[model samples]
Target: MLLRSTKAVFTACTLVAATAFAFAPRTAEACGGCFAPPDPPTVVSGHRMVMSVSQTQTVLWDQIQYAGDPEEFAWVLPVKPGARIEAGTSAFFEVLEAQSAVRIAPAIVDCGGGSSSGCSASFAASDEFGDGSAAPGENGGDPVEVLHQGTVGPYETVTLSTEEPGALNDWLESHGYNVDDSSQPIIDQYVAEGFDFIALRLQPGQGVKQMTPVRVVMEGGSVTLPLRMVGIGTGAQTPIVLYVIGEGRYTTQNFPEALIAGNLLSWDFATSESNYVELRDQALTEDDGRSWITAYAAQNFFNTSVFDANFNSTTLIQFYLNQALANGELSSSCALGLGYFSGTVENPCPPGEPWDSPACGSVEPGALDSRQLGCVGAEDIAVALDGLNVENVWVTRLEANLPRAALSDDLTLEAAAEQVPVNNILTAQIAINPEEACGNGVIPRTIDVSNVPGNRVAALMTTALASIAAALLLRRARARLARR
Candidate 1:
């Protein structure tokens, strides 16, 4: 059957990390539409979700690996109105993870020795929605309506809404999606709430390896995640990690905040991240079930040079011009040139080089370099970056260990009144001491510290005191002998 491509309405899922299924038959009824096929075998792993929000704009990136047949791989997500879906760079996630990852310091040990006069310590620390206009009554006679059809990366996406749950199921089944009766109740719930569903399928001939990160940009709202939908195809326990970027930190509105005890944190070895995962898991488990734990949060300013490659001189010029207009510095019809300076007749471009010159295309395609030809100057880039309002920003990372049972209801997030800045990168760690009685039982490698500053200072001071006392004793003896 030919699939109808058009436009409709619904709510969107927050950062539900990608949950995998084996396409098994359901023994019991589930809450939402099941995307898994019937009676399949073998459960798989690996699900991760990342989200970044700023003001009214939210960017959600989901990473899921399909171990099943490439043709059978499909993803269905619920989104709110005016969400624009796009393909995101995997590097962005990598950068964010590395920058925001928790780090642990090296364990310090005091060897068995006499009192030292001196001691030294050292420490080290480290998308817009598409603008396509939609007309009413685009789909013929079906309660399910297609709102928008677009391709993001390797997947073909269709945004849909339907008043009738049965029609929605039929529409999905006809389009080669596996929607069973178990998903009916969930569909009914979303339909009743007037939520829109986005169905994504790998394009024909595309393998799972071709799948890249998918980004969904939704309009402003308290960031909400559709837990019910996520729990549909997963096991009893699923792990979710989310990164939220905004003006401040965020917390779960429904669940209690899980706190990791700093006292329990310790450095295992200098190079290794110790017991962090274990501690994190323990914290999640201790917080009852389905609790949100703040992992990392920080406020940072990014250099404009980071995004230099994404914009060209033409775009930059236009961007500044728009800013000038918005700030009432220029009229709407004001003409701007590359060399245009405030009341200056001289052009800023070097010799024959004009601002509009082809040499000034954009930043070079590699690492950020202000000296690269075609790159916007540092000052101009800074101004442009300011327009984006990203200079001063907060990044909050939250994680949850959720059982399928806890995901029965949708999750809503509430921003924290005060955001704590993650001034240092935290590493997973367990405390270790050279003489500690209980630990991993593995003795840490010892280093010779006899020549260390504290040891040397102590030895020198002891020798000096001994010499002074000897001199005093000798002087007294000499005086007594002389008197005799």
Candidate 2:
């Protein structure tokens, strides 16, 4: 009974992660559950390093940097074929430079074929916190090498030929591994006998075209849009500002929502480093209660992106911000400082236990009395989406036309989705309750995942600290007994 109670507590505490996602954690079976793959591979490629450890995750609707709607807290990685990984082990990925990257992560199931603990994130980002891009196994600071991903699947190698020399050779050299055929970097695998890597069919290199006009189409209760560049820019013009003025229903707003969400994250607008505007409700019961995030037009090469207060029949994205500008939604930016999110912008260290006991937004770095604007136009879309009421209106896709708002003289969105391998690129799934906006107290659902690094790291730290404190208290109790 004690063990059962403890397990229940641990599981309950584990769901606070904002990174829960839709795509399963690339496993034949869901984490904590059993599954079987069809015609499994016989001689898989990678299956060397496998460890099994349980971890916990925190959940939230990350506004600026995480993902479009919110991010699901789960572990993800692209493996080279022939990897010998298992549960309880960590896998590492190489990262470039010390920069940040924003993404709306997709929840991918492993070779074992299992769903992730949570739904997919509409928006997921690394840079919003202002540190830098965190490789797969990073807790804080430098990324630790993850040799084995916790995902459950047969290890295999990619079986494709390419004219472009892969960075495999250089990667091997850096990792102190040989570049022989038997030593080729493993990418990913599904069937045991076959090998596969996330190959780029339409390579997004040579830079994504600019001012590329883009659009998306919608249907009854479903919207499917393919995103890609329309044209490449040779010359420069004053960066154009595209204000998106709509009601507080933004998440289910479709591709336009994804596009704006991406731009907001990439531009460093979500960080606490800038003067931030806010709107939030103390009551969790309020729908589209009040929250709209926006910023003034930057006189830089980049364009201005803002969310306005308006409503519409169907939420469609835009390539223009003229309507928003006409409505005069520009706020004052005269003396704004880098507004903080997650309360403390630079969390010298990850906040654990009792820290957020009162709540994350309970404390403040800037206006102590303020909260940043999110879902400003989030509710309107939520209502419309809920009205559609498909078994799953909780779905969205990636944007085609990559955005462009030149950087401030020294600022750059170094974090580009293309920078990550095509396989690493994914979209988050959002499931909002028109009935329960953000307050699903008992967010009762089964959590299914195997290898969540973020959770492992947090759990290790939390449990370790707790263990130490308990030990100290026990020592004191023994001393008292001896004295008696």
Against the true structure, what is each candidate's TM-score?
A: 0.61, 0.16
Query: How well is each residue in 91-134 modelled by candidate 2, as lDDT tens digits?
Result: 00000000111222322222223333233221233222111112
Residue 238 of candidate 2: its Cα lDDT?
A: 14
**CA lDDT of every candidate:** 0.47, 0.19
TM-score of 2: 0.16
Candidate 1 local lDDT, 1-484, one digit each (tens): 0011112221344222234432121111112332645434313334445555433345566655434454455667767666667665433443344344444433334344432111221122210000021234677776788888878767788888887866777788887776655666766777787777777777777755424666666654346666676565566765566666544566777677777664455553433334555555677776556676776665542321111122222222233333333323233423334321111011233322435565644432332322211222212222112112343445676767667778786666666756555422332223344334223454444333334543343233332332332233334433544575
Residue 451: error of model 2 in Å? 35
Number of the top candidate by TM-score?
1
Show where candidate 2 strays beyond 4 Å.
1-185, 188-198, 201-391, 395-484
